[model samples]
Target: MTMNALTASAAALFFNHDGEVLIVNPTYKDHWNLPGGAVDIEQGENPYDAAVREVREELGITPPIGRLLVHAWLTVPGRGAQVLYVFDGGVLDHDTQAAITLQASELSEYRFCPPHGMEDGLIPPHLAGVWQQALIAHAEDRITYVPVRL
Candidate 1:
């Protein structure tokens, strides 16, 4: 029997008092995304830990990461399959927001956007839908599963 390997990633969803979600513009990608990266599964890193680590590496702050919000199973056509975990990063106070130090090599900027504005920044467009669902799941204190194909 043969085994198939699927990639995994974890992201942290942060928001402001105004209910705006935080999104980052990556230097390598044309569209914006949440703070996160691929899970280091080969190194024994889990989704939760990857979310925490990615946040620290990207934002330069160790904010409290809360409950899981969404688990997306995505198929990227020729790129194979991937599982994405989105976790609640809680609200970022002004002080914490001011302390952000982006990894210039990987990120260009970060901004807080209203839920309705996510579609304007996210790539593939469907990501905005995933994030919107995540926001809903966050509010309801539940988790959601989204399947996306591209």
Candidate 2:
């Protein structure tokens, strides 16, 4: 029997009082992404821990991470399969918002983007849909699953 390798990544959905989602521009990639990164499965890191760790590493904050919002199955032609988790980072209060410091090497900038502006903020454009679903799942106090191909 043959086994296929699958990787996973975790992200968080942070919002402001104005209902804008937080997004970051990565220095290593052209597209803007949420404040999370690949799950270090090799190092025994789970998705949840990875989310928390990534947020701290990327944004320099340790805000309480809430429940899972979305679980997405993604298939990339060359990269194989990946599972993505989006967790509710909750709304950032003024104090937390003011403390954000982007990782100089990993991120170029971070911004709060309103829902209508996500299409322009996210790369591939379709990612905006996943983020929107995450917002809906958060608001409804539920979880969602989405399939994506890249």
Model 2 residue runs over 4 Å out of place are 1-4
Query: What tens digits encode model 1's per-residue C-alpha lDDT throughout 40-94?
Result: 9999999999999999999999999999999999877656788999999999999
List candidate 1 segments past 4 Å from native. Answer: 1-5
Lowest summed lDDT window (length 10), candidate 2: 120-129
Candidate 2, residue 67: how far the Cα is off, in Å:
0.2
lDDT of 2 by residue, 103-129 (tens): 999999999988667777465465767
Q: List lDDT for all candidates, in order.
A: 0.90, 0.89
Best by lDDT: 1
Report how far residue 12 has shifted in candidate 2, in Å.
0.4
TM-score of each: 0.93, 0.92
In candidate 1, which residue pairs clash?
none
Q: Candidate 1's error at 74, in angstroms?
A: 0.1
